[model samples]
Target: MGIIQSLKRFFSKQTETSEKNHDQALQSHYYKMTKDKTFRELENFFSEKEGFEIRSVSEEHGEMIVKRTKGKPAFIVVTIIMVRPFRTSVDFSVASETMLFTDFGSSRRLIYGLYEELNQRLTFVGTGLGDELAK
Candidate 1:
């Protein structure tokens, strides 16, 4: 592959991998997978690790929204959805802070890395979340 093609493939990772079927299935599979701490943990994760400030969370709905508090970050729009008990599906959408037409997978790397950490810590979900979730 050419350098540009490789960069596009790596950087501008598609959005389809964000919400997965397995993630959907996980929700209905359990009534209380690991208690309702998933969203809370997510709130904490984004804040403590990514330095994202929590904007809002609906505990009843099991969802949260977080974003960068400082200058414009590489990515924006973080949505965490608890599809089912103990199953949380996350989607991170990026709008480059600069004028670049494409990113070198910075967004994908950020989200997937954090997702893997979350899967590891959460322990309810399996690994990688899926390479599909990344480049």
Candidate 2:
């Protein structure tokens, strides 16, 4: 919102999707489903992508680490957790590999793109429902 904050974000090399994030597009997305289905779908989703690579997958922890090898390299960690039955939460952490400190919002854009693609394959409920949904 402010000039300093804008500059900091612009110069940052990483961005993560969280519920409390000020940017709506960067907020964690909620889905009405289970972790198993989400995990499988995500594995397929990234594996099918041209520039992305599934580096590691841990269904036990509901986490996946992926790397983007082409065009502006970046390492992405996708966390998928089922808060409760039929209510799952997905969050993303992206770190860009570049000469400068900034990725010019590329990390944020990548997360947004992932969310968009997953929204199409899964049942999206809402974003930032950790407090209210858990109860």
Candidate 3:
């Protein structure tokens, strides 16, 4: 029983670490049919979110940087890639406000929240979601 419990703990921590370090763009349904539309929708979501301060938006590059003002403050990079003329891919990356490894899970949860709102705001193109985002 002790061994089993230890294994469970180890697996749980490993899962958390894996989730804490992965790219979520490849399998999220947040992809839109158009870059402009996708950007506009994300703009609205990020702008209105409490504690979210959008720093920059590069339409040409289809990317935006948002600073979270809540806790220790972190920078969120939102990137949109146009797969095709009508197929857009949106991805997010969160950086520490300081060069510290303190992003144990808050940043991730924030991303999850963003995706949830995005999924709701944008027309659900498909029901699939990245593992982390699915939670």
Candidate 4:
């Protein structure tokens, strides 16, 4: 190829490589967030409960998997997934027919309890709660 063509190809390849590297870096950052010590503690706490199971766990995607059982359903189903960004200034969610936030663990408990109650009610009726309930 000519000189100009060769230069263009070289620059194009460099741009592609840079974009791939950036994407990889972002993925790694997300993974670190998911595997954070505090987050893991929460995951373990939920996973060890008698009536619940973890469906999936991922820091990169900011999602926590949970499964719950309901009497009317006659079968267990995945429910109550949690998601929160790692670098956000505050944590908040709209689930269980309400919105909640926390700067301290105390508030977190209240929100979680409320969510559980809502989940129980909805699940009892054999109606699935939408993502809004768990956000």
Best by lDDT: 2
Model 2, 45: alpha-carbon shift in Å? 0.4
Ranking by lDDT: 2, 3, 1, 4
lDDT of each: 0.51, 0.89, 0.64, 0.33
All candidates' TM-scores?
0.57, 0.94, 0.68, 0.31
Model 2 bad stretches (over 4 Å): none
Q: Can you write out model 3's per-residue Cα lDDT over 1-135, one digit (the tens) per residue? A: 378754553333111212223333224344656889988988988788888899999999888988889875877778886655665666677665555435455555666667777877776554333443435
lDDT of 4 by residue, 32-90 (tens): 12225435654665566555566666676545645443211111111222235432111
What lDDT is reached at residue 112 by model 4? Answer: 45
Best by TM-score: 2
Clash totals in order? 2, 0, 1, 2
Q: Ten consecutive residues with minimal summed lDDT in candidate 1? A: 23-32
lDDT for position 63 in model 4: 54
Task: Write one digit per residue (lDDT tens) for candidate 1, span 23-130.
Answer: 332221111243356666666777786457777667765555565545446445555554444545555555545466555555555555555676666654542254
The residue pairs that clash in candidate 4, if any, are: 34-59, 95-133
TM-score of 2: 0.94
* Worst ten in a row by lDDT for model 2: 126-135
Model 2, global lDDT: 0.89
Instruction: Write the residue-wise lDDT of candidate 2 on 42-108 in tens digits.
Output: 8999999999999999999999999999988999999999988988899999999999968999988
